[model samples]
Target: MAFSTPRVRAVRHALTAGLLAVAAGLSGMAQAQSSTPIKLLVGFPAGAGTDAIARMLGEKLKDELGTPIVVENRAGAGGQIAAQALKAAPADGHTLFLTHDHSISILPQVVKNPGFNPSNDFVPVAGFATFANVLAVSGATPAKTIDEYVKWVKTQRDGKDTIGVPAPGSIPEFLVKMIGDKYKLDLQAAPYRGSAPMTADMLGNQISAGIASVPDFIENHKAGKVRIVAVIGAKRQPLLPTIPTFSELGFPNLDDYPYYGVFAPVGTPQPVIDRFGTALQKVLAMPDIKQKLTTLGLNVAYEPQGQFAGRVRTYTQSWERIIQASGFVPK
Candidate 1:
């Protein structure tokens, strides 16, 4: 038995085409595995402390991991949008969220359905730093001390005041309510998308005071544009040594510090998580890196994934009690 010339040629052509197709598929898979840039997602706009740190680490991580890293800002809804984005991303370790306590620890507790849960939807990659939030007043505000500010709010502002916050339902908002109750003044929170805008309002006297992390206000405070009157922590921060801690000011319950960290979508391989954790440790260990982050107001430190996750759990539980005591019903 023999095949016709046309049939034989057709069979050869089919075999050649099949081999070429398989090679192309393999090449595509290799490129997908090797060349796609890892995205470091931030829940706030660029120029805020979180975004600044993420970009800094992303630059160094490119060298450490020998791959390109892209910092993507998906800033909105108190980081809910970014958290949801992380949940929707593939669990291949290519996407990670860089956020602070507001998003990971507090948001889910406050919002009825935040679209994702930290324990269920994401895995901690590492913890980098802890920081205290500060209460800062505008340069034009006559008050300097927390006592003086309270007095001014009573006497100068007719017992009512508005303080800008970086986000609604954020720690700062709760602080606004607590401060009002403590001092017996009508204080309300004017929430902004991020600290940059909130600071801008404070500068223009659009809002007389604001509460945000030290890094957000440190530069301005040093410039004599914003006045940091009170800080929240067990001890006074080195950057604002003169400022009194809330504990010193008689509000001991608001002293727990918040953290900055990274997270990957759940189900990401542990080895990939470890690789990132190791790179982050190296980045945090550099003297220059530590100095820069310290200058930016982060108490630069590194915790591996397990320790980081535990910290998140503890912080979340603590805030849960605080929120309940405040009578805050989740929205």
Candidate 2:
């Protein structure tokens, strides 16, 4: 137990060096986690609803994660482009795709190859909101409800009554056919590139009515330019309580609401996914964030990772059955 002073000093020096090395390692890990800016990808154009939501979430998430957040717009093939980009991005927790059910659940059933299967290629980080498609007409139309709109269509002596939908083979487009079958009307479904153009035509009276998300028509409906006759979901939206739901209107088959969720590519570390999910849950719970999404006609609902992934699976299966029943052939 007797040691020279120099030997004791050498032992102290070695212990100090090991502690410094450990500290340096810890510092590097922290720096790596905080230095990189997370890239939040949106599969729609800049002004689209999905893009707007993504930017809003990104703004809040940046503060929560203590890192810069960049929203990248890929914008094509009904969100297939952005989904594919996320699949190819690094699995370092630095990239995510914010999208609605169309890209994750519906597109896979309708497109021959969406480049990535949502359930297979991606892991759900969190579910932020849910929305319902609405059946709305221009203010010029004398229809106060779906029943009235159907009756009014019968009275029109015009060539044919057309209902604009955001895109072909989308839920809105398919609902038009479902409505026609239910009412025995010969209404035509006109597919527009997106809700913006569809809304434009609806505002101009070029189209008798339109089928789009409630947010797509909320502003115009409030402005007295368009009237939302019916919504597709189990219950009336809180933002538009006056508008009845498909179930309330007796169209029970159309009562399905699609969700908006954040997803990371498969093979990402579990810690990263969990961290992002936690941050997203916090972001969604923020009062202002909830208000913004609520005003946009979206229900601010948050589902954690496991629950969100399960929801994606259930939704995909449900959409598969619906799309099959609708006789939609993949393009």
Query: Root-mean-square deviation of each candidate, in angstroms?
Result: 9.0, 7.3
lDDT per residue for candidate 1 within 1-331, as digits (tens), equals 9667988899999999988767655543443457678899999888778888999999998888777899999988989999999999988878999999999999998899999988899999999999999999997678888998999888899999999999888899998998998899999999898899999989998899999999999999889898899999899998988899998978747767899999999987666788888989999999989999999999988999989889889888888888899898899
Stretch of 10 with least lDDT, candidate 2: 23-32
Error of 2 at 226 (Å): 0.5
lDDT of 2: 0.84
Q: Highest TM-score, which number?
A: 1
User: Per-residue lDDT tens digits of candidate 2, residues 133-154?
Assistant: 9999886588888888888887
Cand. 1 TM to true fold: 0.89
Q: Candidate 1 clash total?
A: 0
Query: Where is model 1 more than 4 Å wrong at Cα?
Result: 1-33
TM-score per candidate, chains pooled: 0.89, 0.88
In model 2, what is the error at residue 140, expressed in angstroms?
A: 4.2
TM-score of 2: 0.88
